[model samples]
Target chain A: MRCRAAVAALWMLTVPALGQHQHHHMAPPVSDSLQWRMPPMDMSMPMMPGLEDALPPTQPLLPSMTTPPQARPGEVIPLADGDTLHLTAGPVTRTINGQSLTMYGYNGQYPGPMLEVQQGSTVIVQFHNHLEEPTTVHWHGLRLDSRFDGIAGISQAPVAQGEAFTYELYFPDDGLYWYHPHLREDMQQDLGLYGNIRVHPGGEPEAAPVHLEQLLILDDVLLDKHGLIPWGEEVPTHALMGRFGNVMLTNGVTDFAIDVRPGTAVRFFITNVANARSFNVTFGNLPVKVIASDISRFERQAFAESVPIAPAERYIVDVLFPETGTVAITNSIQAIDHFRGEFYPHVDTLAFVHVQGAEAVPDHRAAFGQARENATVTNDIDAYRSHFDRPPDKELELSVRVQQLPLAIMLSMEIDTLYVPPVEWNDAMPMMNWLSTGAQVTWVLRELSSGLENMDIQWSFTQGDVVKVRLFNNPRSFHPMHHPVHFHGQRFLVLEIDGVRSSNLVWKDTATVPVGSTVDFLVDMSNPGSWMAHCHISEHLQSGMMLGFTVEAQNQPR
Target chain B: MITLLPFLLGGLMMPPTPGVCVWTPEYYQIALLPTRRVPEARQAEGAAHVSFVESPFGIAVTRAGHYRYKLELRVSGLREIEGHSYVAWLATPDLKDYQRLGPMPANNVLSTEVYWNKFIVFITLETAAAPEDASWQGPVVMRGMSRSGLMHTMAGHGPYQQEPCTVYGYY
Candidate 1:
């Protein structure tokens, strides 16, 4: 076992680009031995100085942008079981990468304050909208009433501009959840205005073993020659691909460093909130065990060196630092430049972990085993296993195309254009990005059942119907792209990937469907409401690559 | 650059329908003009198909001079360009004047009113938010002339000044 750990460390140094090749193969088994560690190395990719940052959104900000007050991160008011928490949504001036820019925020914080509560406790949030545009907070990955689901048109009307609305949030399940604006989400969410929520179990065990915990919010911002790229209000900025950020951020800070004892166990609640970019995170010389995915625990923890998290997805992992050194957390993914049909290997450092002390913490040796003895993990196994025998109820295909016509011919065509409505803080010019928004219409999802593509109501299922759906991304497309498919208000089990039935039955709301790949999953349609299933990449969502379906009540006809 | 000129009525190969031709499940091919993206050689190789049907007096009688016909259209591989809209037109064989149909819908099927024989049926990509005019301004994408025949009925002498007399009754 020690020899295998040493070999793994040596392999990390010799074959630096192993991640690019290993993803094509099946995932490795979880290591039982906890000693496989790689030494520190230089955190720079081959193409460092010339990689272009993401361009600004289609529309630039006007000069008369609103600048609201900022909030302290530690100023969250603690609430008892049923108290009401007040939150204000407005603009705030935040400085990132030594530049100050105005962005929309909740309670004046870039990433809004953490709202913690106990399981089964119904809490009320006095959501006040103070921005120039309408906004609503969507509780991502939570099963709640449909009225508070936060979708603009489907769930409920958006909180009107300069108005107040109260949300009655009931937390039935215990896990990590998040909140963000739903209307014009590509603009509001990208420019801050996101936060996390944690629901603790009711019956807490006293004197639980002490372990270091950190909640890392992963995000990025695109900067152009004119400082922070402005958010598009009317038209999506990078419609070909999403507007990806160049500067990496963790917990709203660039230099997110942590000091810990040499041999202590640490748990990280990691969430990816970037608009388009996927964060493939790896800790130098540290092997982490993935304990939970999205909002629930896995049957058994799986150990991996690097894990890729897509937009609006969450993962909880635990790692024990054995040796004393400074290790950097790095992102190891190749971002495709859709315009030029090129790939840029973006391997950059995100944060640092410092280990100094000598002795291991005495109480945290059995932390991994103690964390899994919860009631939620035991209750979900039988419900998931019962649906493995049923065949898939439907099949769908995800497709994208890039077509080019002469510029003069495109300019001569008559198009039905939709403009951004009037806003005080936005520029008056009717926003138009002909090259990005008009050149190519890519990212389409087709349902074979109805032969309808893009925004078509594909199906209607009754509540409690266990359905298996097969999603295909074949090689016949004009260009290959990865899509993080998300289903609102439902949690599904990933049964198979590329025809390989998964041994681990982890529940996920958003699953990454890679290029030229197929994924089959089982969805227990438990929530009775109109839910949307679409790609989570913000640009693709804006370009009509989405569909909605209703889960009717059990007694009602579909 | 091979330019597709207006196909005169005499060159049509399909025989024209007699009276109130009922539309069927399938559509017959008309003109197939190549757009800027697709060249003449490629379209000739069957890259895409543009077909339509005419059902006279199928829906209603319009305020215009002719009886309203449901002009159904279908295009297999036609795509949506970002800043442009696809517009259909009905024009004379001599390229004299064209009646502007509205912008194409998302489903690629539209019901329009057309009563002219010996006319050309074509589609063009239009600029964003262009005026919904009755004239053709952009280059042609797919063009085909209608199956040629003479009109089945002439103007009737009535109180409505050479208009067809209304025979209102229950079917």
Candidate 2:
């Protein structure tokens, strides 16, 4: 039988056979209907008929969930040329800020471990899934074979419990990248299953003359009065704007502060791993230059006053503290009124840069020497200027809207409901888990021209076609949004904003489309495959805001 | 009758020129109509008609010698609007960054300079107090985009309605 949700079915088979774990099953069994396809990935509980209608103010707590995974510190299994490093995914407990939260990790490390490899070298990882649930490690932002894209159902099946898989990664470009579990990213990633990949250029990897090199895996953990909030058991809730972390964390540390010397340049590798929140990072009056973004260098250095780092985007910047003073690293968020009625401009200290010690020699020149020399490297905008004057081959509009009736209302009043005995709802707080069922939110995206929703193949382009695309966000949407539109297995240049030509062109796989703005890009369809272009915010993807596009290989006789 | 005759005669004298600048209903629909609208309350009170003209044919001009587009509006119930003032702005159809065209003149005929080829003429009712930025805030009263003798060098709908608007020139 052709199952619409082959992914969900494959995920179900990965559940542990232990009888004690059976009670955790909240997901409805796979059905033949098309509606059953594309079930929410983290939904483990079934809905009871009356439970939703009469949303009680409170409910009982669940028995202490399985002992939080024990800690297995990140271990470095060094790999020589043509060698493989063995990695395992399993339950682990990590204590941070005197709070021990049970979560899963790679090699028992909260952020796993950084995989360092030289450019032009190949590294293989033998991944073993030891967790009770299914999971797959997706090499985020890696330009590799589509089969190893790590997307469940589309790229490969979920790695079953006790199953082992191997990923042979070839580093063509030297930059920063990351890895995370593609299955239940909202849940797994939030708990911890993310790490960084640093691909240094070959031949001694001439290091930028910086006093200190810092790689910060920027993430957040939402906590309530009881400490770590209960995981969204049935479905990852906060479906509208995603669950914003009340406790801002960097490298899983609540109090993230770094030491630096005056007049010394510090190279910072920053990646936003939060499921949603976009951080507008700034150092108080510190002179800085953005050297690279998304692992690709900019043609020339651009002064960084404030940089908006959205989820899944990376930036490498060099900062020089002029004087000996503590410069606060703050996230200035403005114009965000999703839950709040008024636009509140807030400056939050995500981390602090305590500048101490004696002034050291600043090497700002060497920091940018490699970048400036290799400016026209692997793939840059200058190489594609020939097609700049040519007309765009395709135009696309990205739009989102809420359905007339809430999905929760429809599911509660209509559709079949599965009843769970009262005891199962308990988990520190019953109402908390129930709230995360994601019944109230039903957001949808469509290719405005075709009017087709989610996963529909909207367009096809031949390989090597220089396609210019105009992606405009619908201003009239019920809830206007800023989308970090990401294209898988492809890179493009942002040509213009609203109609004004951009002065500096940068190659990017993900571009942030502000609300009520049209961004024009020259899409170099060099990678041939069926890829996805969607909002990078985890909740948006879950709400069906993604679509498929194909790049057909040239010279193939069809 | 004497005052309205000059306005009518002025419009009739310059019978909309036929060229790349012709303003048809489709041009308005393509540029602005689908994206903006007058609120239901404003629509129920009275209808507003907005018309515009580009340079070479436009009657509006700036002191700076820039070709200013002429914008004329006949909107009722402005006198009834209290505690707030209506302001006009030029913005892209998506309503991104906008250029304030100043408050609506009591007489309603206004002229302002614009840069983009595809843009919407918007009138927003703002608080009586001064605004922080020149951009539009509060509810939109009327919205529209104009096509005139000026070159429409922006993206437009393709020959096939189903196709993406990849063509970025005058049809």
Candidate 3:
């Protein structure tokens, strides 16, 4: 422990002390509730010729914008088969943590109304962009047509200001999916403009004994006493580690609470909609059975104490509450404390489940105790296994490159290279991350086979082709941070990690490739359309770290 | 350049339904008949038709990936014994490992669906309580192989690489 502590001390001392002239040092404690690890902005000396050291979020908003009316919680709107709905994006005023703040919303709510549709049914959404800038709603995890996939520059152009676009969406798979802005997700999605889509089986609900269900959209907002710490007007500022929010929100609100009956099985459809932060969700550290992944149910259910969810990823877990006892639904993880020179447990209370009632009428506790064997997912993925052992058809390495970042930031990153954790639980260097804008930092997705980076690489495949792709998070880069990679029009199986084959498989559209880890997946090119794959970190995506691909239609018979 | 115009809905096809799975079953074929143990090894006279069913939603009509395979067989001239029952079994194409799929629910019909990729389906005559260990302890009665199971010709590898028989051995 002493040796490990010394090593952590070396990482904590990222900046050298060139004597008060210009040095990056950990500031004194800002607040008793939250400890800030950023360099001291008020420390007389500047961070080696940087603009001004930094702006701490604890400061009050100098010019506070008028908070609109208090926004209401997002509503659930269920649409029938072939229903047409109009979705408008506009500004909504919300009181976050006793401070009135302004954020974007769809249909005048913080989170757009949850749209519940049936499987295999087509619904029309006439989306009107009421915001100031252009935006396109990318259905996060759907196998819809290329046009309705909502990706700007690929399927269709962005909905310009005062323009409207109609989306004919079909929910091919019945599970939890979300929609957010594909253009400028760093600003649009971070300030709201996201919602859930729950597609149920067309016929009827399954016999799975789940009683009550909860849709928990997990998000985090970077806010200070002065309201939302301003977004970068130039380029995405937090491109280094993306924006790790200080305040965690559940369903776009703080102190969220739910009432549940004891001895009843509740299925929680949890989605991590945060711009950067990945959550390790735990319901008071109790056991929960993971039923479904992003696209569909897992071949085998996993019983886990916590679920690690990356950005843009969704997981469905069923929890059977005991007789009584309030359970705090939380995201608990170990965050690195550079100031204290150690790691500390950080638990954010996202919500609470008040379980104080009699057992449910039709108690599904017995059936919830057992997991089902799904033949469908197994058979669906059978074809992809053939390419599992062969050499990967394509390989991409994830890393960050900088052209002209400030000296202080570069010095700190170079020194801290000695110890970079597998998963960055917290923004250890918030000042450096906040200053590393898109102009200087370039998060790259380089194809190893062709030596092409980002947009320069174009991967093409035929429909029904099972393509194997390897994602390696190169640890030798300037700064290696875990990235949640998302593919637009395909569902993939996490085939293996590093060299070990993954025995438990689940179909997913987004997965977190941890720092220095190697992930191999098989993309089922069943959807024919121009698609894109990129890091889901909103700011990282803004830093030109994305690639486009094509899945040509099987225009002929096999 | 990316396509800017909306895709034609008519051009889109309704693909296979994304099926439900919480656990996977080993791909095995039940191809057995008890007549081999009898004098002269009598031939079992029966025919079965196996088809794929869509996930509970019944979405797939033209596409065929996500399917739960079902076999329906009606064999004539089957003698029923007092202490024995007809059981359906799934076995590796080589007839080595076996999994008991319980006794025929009703009549002389084996009405059930399986998810095995390539395996032989066979029937067996076992005591009322079939063996639990997937061991071959009963008399083989009938054997039927799927088209995918035929990927492996009796001649080893035979230039096909035999992936259909090897890689899909998912339990």
Which runs in model 2 stand beyond 4 Å of their true positions? Answer: A1-64, A68-80, A203-208, A335-340, A362-374, A377-379, A389-391, A401-442, A553-558, B1-171
RMSD of 3: 18.7
Higher-ranked by DockQ: 1 or 2: 2
Report the number of the highest-DockQ candidate.
2
Best-matching candidate per TM-score: 3
Candidate 3 wrongly placed segments (more than 4 Å): A1-69, A203-207, A339-341, A556-558, B1-171
Candidate 1 runs further than 4 Å off: A1-66, A74-78, A202-210, A334-345, A358-360, A363-379, A401-435, A438-442, A554-558, B1-171
Best-to-worst TM-score order = 3, 2, 1
Worst 10 residues of 2 chain A by lDDT: A417-426
lDDT of 3 by residue, B17-113 (tens): 2322111111112233335663322555664554333221111111111224555665644567778776777765666666777676556666666
TM-score of each: 0.62, 0.64, 0.70
lDDT of 3 at A111: 79
DockQ score of each predicted structure, in the order shown? 0.01, 0.03, 0.01
**Worst ten-residue run, lDDT, model 3 chain A?**
A55-64
lDDT of 2 by residue, B4-122 (tens): 32233233222323222121211112122211343432442221222222211111122211213334444444443667777777776556767887787776556555634345676
Query: What's the distance in Å from true for residue A178, model 3?
Result: 0.4
Using DockQ as the yardstick, the better of models 2 and 3 is 2
lDDT tens digits, residues B11-40, model 1? 443333432211221112354544454342
